[model samples]
Target: MDISTALLTFLHILIPIYWLGGDLGAFYGSTFMTDPKRSVAERMMALKILNNIDMAPRTALILAFPTGLALAWAKGWVQIPGEWVALAAVACLAWLGLAWKVHLDHGGGGGAKRLDIWIRYAMLVGLAVAGIAGLKGAIAVPLFIGIKLCILAACIALGLLVRRALVPLFGAIRTMATTGPTPETDATIIQVNEGARVLVLMIWALVLAASFLGIATPV
Candidate 1:
């Protein structure tokens, strides 16, 4: 393979590997956080670990767009314009920056958080539109590629759902930190975790499917 193809191929392999690996670590940390036998401090540590590990998958998700597009272009699987590919790379970088900022400022003021949420919504819409266009022959790509895009969009949606589920979990953590852990607080943590786990698992499955489609290119 040439340099461009080699680089894109490397990224294509790396992204999903890190994404799934990080997600598994996060999942394990979350399970520890919900373990009733663990002390509050231990659970809190697990939560911190979970949050930090989650950044890997979040970064991968943002980067996937540009990387996948570039790969498709390089492999002659798609004929996207160079300008569009450049625009996508810039946008992906910006999105990755915003995602990290939001993570760093988890419970801070409004601006960054609001912008990040809007960005995610915009990405969701963009991916869905791209998939629909490809499927409709507006974009010249294989059916499997379009389906993979749709699955990726679904994974993003599932991520947002998991975030929504974790809202209460965050609140419960704060409550525990402020007033010590209680049975009620523990129960709330466990409940939120269970709900989030379902969504997260769905995301994992979608991501794996997308990866398979990208590799197999099965129509």
Candidate 2:
């Protein structure tokens, strides 16, 4: 790969790691969700993780589009049906917008619930298509594409599950906008921290898929 392509590929891989690892750390950090935790310090640690979890997704969202577009441009792979292309673009835009909301709205309810859910569903589609497209010239089309696609799907699903899991806690925060975060709310955030494992999985999947595609030189 040329230097530019190499850097883009590296960024693609890095974004997911930063995104998933950060998100996963935040998710798994919450050990007190189902339980009323015995220690205040532990809850505090989990809350800290939750506070930063948004950063991962936000960064990933920024890179996903341009990298995906660049890959297609570099390979002249824009042969996707016009309709599919339009759909892909729309999905990309929507995903970006939703991810932005996740950060702009942060932990509040200013419209993140719906956006978060839709982002996962849309990304699930986009990742599926892009991953398959990566198989066009691969050395191991069946095994590589299928496995990577599966991993991406699982990552998207995990993202969705985490979003769903966070709804109640986020709602609580919204409800308590005036009252401020309580011990219970803090615990809930910590609970979400346990989902960090999913983010880590996402990061790994991105690395494997991108490197495989580059090596496969799929077009």
Candidate 3:
């Protein structure tokens, strides 16, 4: 492989490592955070740590698209304009910056969070459309690549669902923090986690599927 292709391939391989690894950490943190047996302070600490650990997977996910696009271009799998690729890089960087802003400021309900979510919606829609078109032979995309795109889109959708499910859990956490843990708050936390767990598992499956597609190309 050419040096550029090799580098892109390396990045392509490395991202999933952080993405999956960080997710595992976040998963553990979530379980610890929701345990009713744990002290309130301990649960709060776990929640804080979970948020920080989640950033790794978030960063990996944001960069995954641009890296895959650039790799495709470099490998001659698709003809992408240099300007378009550069634009993608810039946009992803901006997205990453916005995400970090939300993280550092600890502002969960603001314009920044809304903007980030909107950007993810755009990415999800774009990937979904591209994957469908590629699979239908309406676009000049390779079969395995098309499948991988769809897998990525599924992952993003699952992530969004997980986020939505967690909103209630956070609300419960706030209630618990203010008034101390109650059966209601604990139940809510458990319920939300149960729902989110399913979505998270789906995301894990999609990530694994995408990795397999990239590695084996078994379309």
- Residue 64, candidate 1: how far off, in angstroms? 0.8
> Highest lDDT, which number?
3
Worst ten-residue run, lDDT, model 3?
72-81
**Clash tally, candidates in order:** 0, 15, 0
Question: Can you give the TM-score per candidate against the true fold?
Answer: 0.96, 0.57, 0.95
How far is 31's C-alpha from truth in model 2 (Å)?
5.9
lDDT of 3 by residue, 1-219 (tens): 978889999998988999999999998998987899999999999989998999998899999999999998887777778889889989999999999998898866599999999998999999999999999999998899888888888888888888887888878889989889999999998899888878877888888888888888654
Predictions: Cα RMSD each: 1.2, 6.0, 1.3
| Residue pairs in collision within model 1 | none
Please write out the lDDT profile of model 1 over residues 1-219, one tens digit for every residue.
898799888987898898999999998898889887888789889989998999999999888888998888888888768888889899889878887888898647589888888888888998899998989999889898898788878888888888888888877899887888889989999999889888888888888888888878876
lDDT of 2 by residue, 105-196 (tens): 64467567566666568667866775666556432343444445545655666666655666666655443344555677665555554455
lDDT of 3 at 98: 97
Q: For each candidate, what is the lDDT? A: 0.87, 0.57, 0.88
Question: Candidates ranked by lDDT, best first?
Answer: 3, 1, 2
Alpha-carbon shift of residue 21 in model 1 (angstroms): 0.5
After superposition, the stretches of candidate 1 with alpha carbons farther than 4 Å from their true spots are: none
